[model samples]
Target: MEKYIEIRGTNLFVKYLNPDSRKPTIIFLHDSLGCTKLWRDFPEKLGNATGCNYLVYDRLGYGKSDPMPTNPRPSNYLEIEADILNDLLIKLQIDSAILFGHSDGGSIALITASKYPSRIKGILCEAAHIFVEEITLRGIYEAKELYKNSNLAERLEKYHGNKVDILFNAWVETWTTSDFRNWNIEHFLHNISCPVLFIQGEADEYGTMAQVEKTVAQVKGKAEKYIIPNVGHTPHKEIPDQVLDRTIDFILQLAH
Candidate 1:
């Protein structure tokens, strides 16, 4: 179930659970500096709870996947990632998918659902950013400092290995760039007609409530929001039971 699959000429580390199942697949996308291994057992637990197959993969330049070119990434990188996800779905022969994405992965999920509505059945995104915010930049700046001063890089190495620096730099440098300030994906929201659930922590350090509010207002889909009190950034990891219960209810409702 775990193997390397060539996606757009890059070998991506992919883990597929119950690939032969006829039920819709739930594709789990990790946050920046995260990989297939970082997702741990959340995918399996969710899959078992919903009786749905699940897929998890390391993006190029992360985990067991092939490295990417070391160059400045363009502002539209998330959109490019969305295109890659579409191709990956085609290569894997997945007819339908429900995306569960976190952080940067959440943004990618929104873009993918917008561009490929037919292939996407629904979306559940946590802490997804549509545009640059001062709070977001502050969080990244703080993280950059932590990476330089603390053992953050060392901890990340356990998951990303030698590719940790590249992945971390890719996330920090790209988001902190001045040109990326105007980098917004709101234009694509109206194109997303499928159901979407935007989940975020009320105490999230990286973004504010505006992120969840604007997303629910802009998306053309039947949009809902779940703002978890006292949680920060990652609700699934912080309060797995609450997230699991809410997500299960969401998926079950989608079946009707």
Candidate 2:
């Protein structure tokens, strides 16, 4: 089911699938420029494979959700997003959730798991960054160039519609800022007690293996890493079968 739910006073676009109250819900969080639609059928496929409920939503400034109230977002934006996710779970009465987050979404999941450990069963973070790296800045710079020269903007428009510019600029501008360079959430890592599965591509342009290594080393809970060879930033999209198989194994183990 798809609908607009008021979250933190903002109308956010949400989609729920395979609502089985008896099973844990797998919440899929998209990347910086992604939304509900951008997740495509992965949620459904995963939901069916695991026989678990799944939820996907567009963040405040992306997709069908309300636009961000302000531009040049604060440095703690991801932390705020984590708080919003916690509130969302409370409002929805979701007692158990396994977060599957990518990129920015992955960082948000880590933050949420640290701050609100009760509801989170586990976390699967793909290409999540704990701290800003020089490589990350380089990737963002390249993306900015792509947006200006290529059809990247036009392609994003198909998903974000008129709000495309705001969403794109928000990502580029915030990440490029000097203050945001020091934006790091590593302090929250020690607080995450729930089991975490860190997945990343060996060829990821935005971050290095340090992202997965440090995350695996810091988290207080049982942590594992899956480094896919020859894959870029998005491992799931690049190799769905491998990701699906591994994710299913992880979630099934958690269920038991």
- In order, what lDDT does every prediction score? 0.91, 0.92
Error of 2 at 72 (Å): 1.0
Ten-residue stretch with the least lDDT total in model 1:
16-25
Across 79-147, the per-residue lDDT of candidate 2 in tens digits comes to: 999999988899888999999999999999999999999999999999999999999999999999999
Off by over 4 Å in 1: none
Give TM per candidate.
0.98, 0.98
Cα-based lDDT at residue 65, candidate 1? 92
Query: TM-score winner among the candidates?
Result: 2
CA shift of 148, model 1, Å: 0.7
lDDT of 2 at 163: 88
